[model samples]
Target: MQTKINKVELRNLEFDDYKELKNSMVESYPEMVGSYWREHHIEKLLSIFPEGQLVILVDGKVVGSALSLIVNENLVDKNHNYSDITGKYTFSTHNPKGDVLYGIDIFIHPNYRGLRLGRRLYDARKELCEQLNLKAIVFAGRIPNYGQHAATLTPKVYIEKVKRKELHDSVLSFQLSNDFHVIRVMKNYLEGDTDSKEFAVLLEWNNIYYDESPKLINLEKSVIRLGLVQWQMRQLNNLEALFEQCEFFVDVVSGYGSDFALFPELFAAPLMADYNHLSEADAIRELAKHSEPIRKRFQELAISYNINIITGSMPYLEKGTLYNVGFLCKRDGTSEMYSKIHVTPNEVQHWGMTGGSKIRTFDTDCGKIGIMICYDVEFPELSRLMADEGMNILFVPFLTDTQNAYTRVKHCAQARAIENECYVAIAGCVGNLPKVNNMDIQYAQSAVFTPSDFAFPSNGIKAEATTNTEMTLIVDVDLDLLKELHEHGSVRILKDRRKDLYEIKKINT
Candidate 1:
């Protein structure tokens, strides 16, 4: 057959060509490759050759191709051949060393064969094997006629020949002519009914090495240590007592060499008895009085200790409304505030507090930090959005008295930390708050957590203070550890999260 010749160049292939490649293969090999199983094999090929490296060109058009992947799998049986039905040409077994597999199947149009195109296509696939630095190239082809009709062959006979390399002569006839040799024949134990049609022989070419270009190593990285404090509540029947206690805790936290300290939800609150003792107006007044003192004390703490302190969640009276606010206190006594973007029904119904409308991440000298209050942590999107914004630390201030509150808190904190590759710090109210409906007020266990590790013991206790008690717990964190986990850890909780497999939506308001 005569054919036109055109320039051939190698380039990256698009994934959308899957259907086209399938159509081409099925159209040419209806007998050997059927339409029913073509989808399965094509899907496998798409996954393996996402960039379409296994391709062939004839007259500047794609005509033939092969699919392969480099994986670590043990040929444990010592009698297994992947080349036959599995189409797995390469594998590595840990015990006796391993090999990178190269698998490819080449198909030619019936009208274009007289030009020795089969060897040309095989040569093209060989180039791919060399490019991948594969150990061996293995495949199975039709068995030569054995004086019996192809339909007369039994599955047992096919399996037996596949295990014995009985067709080495015919296989080597074509392969050996191209510097290939029959190394062994192994049974397709995992092939199921697919291998019932014919037997196959495995082939290998030894001592063939390909040269690779040298790569320059770029190991430069930046590391920052971060800390989050959450769940700090300052509620006292007397505004005077609340400020006094907050001032004291600030002084004590300053005494420690903490880079950052976080306080929990509603860091400042006034006593509300059955919603009668304190009206809406009185609540705002108390919050205002506590705000300046609380802000000043945290400012002093941050400046004096040369650290950053997240003052946790406080009620910020904004225009005729109230917002749960978090602050980042800097060493210079300056502070940045982020209002809570999500509020629970309890806040809207019980506290008459509305949620904030936007997400805000702080740009710190160390790295970006995200701040959200109690109810916000319950919503995965808040933390996930912060993580997507490149925040390395999530500061959560929480207030809860639920049973196993701390355990639940710790679980969520650790999960967010691992999933976002960020640090989560929780500051919680441990002591009792004013009586609520006939139940005593609640608090969550407080702690600092990294991606896979917690700074506190496994008992889920990072640190705790008595409810309605006065205390400060300062813990140090290493941001570099988070970066390390992202770079080297196999359990990449954050990177491994499959958004395509799950629906992800954020509830901002």
Candidate 2:
């Protein structure tokens, strides 16, 4: 005897399933009218990233489908319309090595709406993101029910109410429950979508495991602005005094809408006043104790100010050994730690500071970046390794007791910009810290340097601070210029490297 059993399965979309997929899309979006994918459309998507295209079957019948593509993400503007994102139905925007998994379409059969099929499709996308190590799952989702309230409420207010749960939207509410947030409301996003009033919301679901993944967003930004702080060495009464000063600069930089804010090395060293009577090494060890507290505070400030911060170099103690460390406190409430790879002879002799073992370039919303300390910037090999990692900007925070020491860092950093074909921003301390041993006076001339090319300033200096003054220098840089220089400039140093003869590599990860 033969028996019938129920079975449901989810799998990658295939070319033969296009007809069934089209029927399901129509049933899910009856009012969509003329907006539906054809056979070639499904063919192109599967050809590009088959893992991103999925379909669900109920007892051998296709009941739902989801189509996606990988995009550079830097080209995904919030105000972009549907045609702009989809490449006018040709899917020409698909990039094989892109960082974002873009969900171009998702729909379920009308009869299968209550089976949680939509959620299943979404979970699959998240899994794909984790497997591929992409930054996020981004898409423009329609507000289908908004057409009903279009006469009374604006799209922005409607979205706000949906978030607050005062109003319910079928598509948006489901997405929010699936951990997606609306970046902004867009106009004329789709054609012939009367139910949505031609509006959509730019939604994003960040992959939490992105940091562990290889940095894939090398060309993430086009226009990026940076803020550099020329800090003044001073004596502080307590830790709170240092906190107040740190918050002030963060506030000023964020107000200028700068994406990143840099503070000089040892900006928190003002707390050394309490340990003035101790030996220099012991005083630094005592300063290391405050590193944790200040780290937590900088993380808070980074979140509150909506700016990425390089919390200048601080003394860190591990296994009773002292190391100079700095953190990249991101506005997303995450942080990355890096240390000075090359410790200075003066530092080793006076403070017993040990060199750090690991180094890495960072991934940011604007672009890829690298961090180096005072003495580390004097070495060309370190920055070259970072350039190989696709670093677009290098931030150096230094502490110099004399003009000669400051000059060494500045010249080497500028040369790094020219040779690596990237931007380098260097900052250091100024003024005097009287009564503190080995910390009496400081010298600095904080500046932002760019690649030497026709696209940048003739002198390669984008912006500079007044010598030895406590102030902020804000400058804008176009990363696209770096791309052009790499491909078409008069002298393409990065692409023209003599790799066949000489190469640089890190011995261990």
Candidate 3:
């Protein structure tokens, strides 16, 4: 009576499924007397090796499970029994630093037996083995039909017959079909078992595709040389002068061998200076009209310099609504746009700007990176989400009119670096825009920050410009050092996160 396994979902075992898992195991193997796995054993296995446990659901009902643990090759001797490898079913021998995956148990409920659910479980184990880069999978396979042949054949002879397709023992045939070869046989592997006559066949599945070579640390891809610009504001007579100012900075930074150059938030505000005669709202609207041309010029500059450029931000008008947008232009001429997700009260009240709804990370030659405009970087959850997506660098472009505002941005940027274990580079406007009404009297100092640990700078500041100055600060950040900090630093904040207790997940509409 095989049930049709429509809508089967394979997922990691959750602690909430402990009761169902135990019930399924007891119901599926009722023939073995006194061979019940208690809840404490499952809890211990999950506490130590949760990644090795998997469960299968058919139409929203738990139907099967596969349990495994990692161990060193030395622990699995050629003649060892199941108890020696599994620590008497308590799985106390599970090792986090092991190189081989040892199968503990796999079972499918009786109602779902012949629908090939076991094959799906086995395939999952193989995938997990490859993903963890384990050298092999070793398990003691039960020979359910071996008792009938035990009087006439030895375990080795029985396995040989099974391999040659002359014998059809269910468990051995399935393992052989899945590329497992019998290493040897073990006696007294499990107690009170009519199956296998209290003997088990040792099977090994070698990962032929596993690479044993040492991984070379790529410094070229791991190190990003950054150029941070504290842009100065001035009265603009025309767009040509604005282009010249941007070109000057791009040329100078590219000449200094910067892999990526960052410009301050609202660096192009001076372009709005020419529209002072109009109302403040009208002036911002006029500024939005130049977003396209400005983006094109930035792209050209990025291509000419052969460096990635983060164009602080520009006022963009789309579908009669304005948004503050930043353009990340790469040397290859491809660009991504990040709209300001957190709009300031001033922007909403005065300019009728709306906040962006989406957040994303960009894949670049250097590494995964994220862009957060001034107010967006102040939020911890946004940066944490980016960090979860493997972002190594965060670029922030800001505009502040007072020292207090500048300090807030700087402190928050540094905090994001420390909490997320990532590099944060902040660039801002430093000079005044007397002609512009709402954007006058700028104060800023640009800085690059790293995680606060031994792997990074002691002060957490990689390079900082003089306060209230128009300057470019250049620094080289090691991305490899970030990897080390995340894994083995003073505190592994990323790895130590309690995902079961609380998680920061994105909701999709």
Candidate 4:
């Protein structure tokens, strides 16, 4: 048997490909044989708007298709059905001067399903919708599997379940996953569509970059207000006290509607004052014991306060070795850990801390972010790796005991913001722990940084806390500005990288 190479590409559906298109359509909806689209229908659509007729070709053979046509949203009512929108099979509803792209048909062959070809087709439609300056991509999406649950569930309830991920519809599920939302449940959408039971969903995917009026930039989700907590070293009698103080700051940050609430690296070290009598290494391990419970409580605080909390950095014990790690507790009740990629000499000597092995970008409700603990921010490679992953902000939680040490983290982090063209926020422990060894003294001036350009602050420091003071510095950083700077800035290091001479790739472990 000869080895067959599978090559997949997308192109406009041509009139000559009508036979294979009908064949693939029937493979999914066999009950509607003659009722499906015919050669004349394909020729008519191609003649009217050829770019909207997209087909996926695998090994030079058409396997799937996404069909769409422009429609004036003002002329059509929201209650319109499939036949009415398709102009009684004549497609008279297609308007060249329209505000929306009305999706009419989509189908895939059984052998080519699950390859995400539908997403590619949807993307092509979205690109065309944006390029044509359309307001949105509107479609009547079929709930074909609604018949299975119609005996007990209503169409509205079924759609709700699908949106909540409690239920799945072959078509609607895929659409919802691709950012399309249900405007409402549509009825009598198609004739003799048994699987759908004559029900459909009015779905829409808005184009963010659509130009209604001349503007500098257009983005719905951009600005992320952050609150950096410059935590103090205090005498806490128990673990609850530490949590209470942390919760208070979270409350304040959340009250101001900040997207992120960050604490200092080892800010919870005050809890380790209880184990001060143990050896330095043993005490760090004891601090590791509190990591699990604190992560849990911070997660609760994140949900209750409705703020994302970076729990700074703490000692993490795995197997027999110890590592420094931070927990990013998102308001959605999920916790992610970012271990320090590079451990300091003092940490290795005193706490038996080893560097972590994995690093990846974090997806938050606000935007893509990354966490690099104290010493990790000093290395340029880590932040560059994060920038490659489209990181909008980088959080550095440090615990430098000397003013020089603090300056090292501060200067390098600022450099990262300039070079990566992303925001950088740093918070660290202030004051001192009288009892805890190797953690006796600390210094930090929590600050938020921005790319050094005309759009940003002159010094690139958005806001900064008073030196070694326990306070939260609240600042709103415009992610839209970063997008603008990435393209047209004084220096474009990311785009100007000499990829022909060098490249950076992550090695899989």
CA-lDDT, candidates in order: 0.57, 0.89, 0.87, 0.88
Question: Native-vs-model 4 lDDT?
Answer: 0.88
**Which one wins by lDDT: 2 or 3?**
2
Worst 10-residue lDDT window for candidate 1 reads 89-98
Per-residue accuracy of model 2 over 270-322 as CA lDDT, tens digit each: 78878989999999899999999998999999999999999988999999989
- Model 4 worst lDDT run, 10 consecutive residues: 213-222
| RMSD each, Å | 18.5, 20.6, 17.7, 17.0
Question: How do all the candidates rank in terms of TM-score, highest first?
Answer: 3, 4, 2, 1
| Candidate 4 per-residue C-alpha lDDT over 1-509 given as tens digits, one digit per residue, 9 for 90 to 100 | 11453698899999888888887787867767676688888889999999899998888878889898899987445588888898988889899988899999888887788788888998899889978999899998888889999999999999999988899899999999777877888888887888889988999888765667654643335788999999999999988898889889999988999989998888888877889899999998988999999999999999998889999988889998899988999888999999998998988888888999998999887879989998888899889988999998999999999999999999999999999999999999899899888889998999999999999999999999999888889999998788768755888879889999997778886
- For model 1, what is the C-alpha lDDT against the true structure? 0.57
Model 4 stretches astray by more than 4 angstroms: 1-220
Clashing residue pairs, candidate 3?
A: none
Q: lDDT per residue, candidate 3, 310-382, as tens digits? A: 9999898889888899899998899999989999998888888988878889988798999999989888899
TM-score of 3: 0.61
Model 3 lDDT, residue 188, Cα: 86
**Which tens-of-lDDT digit does each residue in 1-509 have in candidate 1?**
33666644333334555565666576656654453224555555555555324555555555555554443334422455444334343222211122444344555545554555557656655666556665555544433332243366453454345345554333235665555555444444323324223344455553244323323653212343333333343346665566566556555665665556676676554343323356554554455546656777778767766777788777777776877777789876789878877776666765577788877688765668888776677678778878877788787787776756656666777778777877777777655545433124655556666665443245433344444344555665556566556644646676767788984555655
- Once superposed on the true structure, which residue ranges of model 2 sit more than 4 Å away at CA? 1-220
Best by lDDT: 2
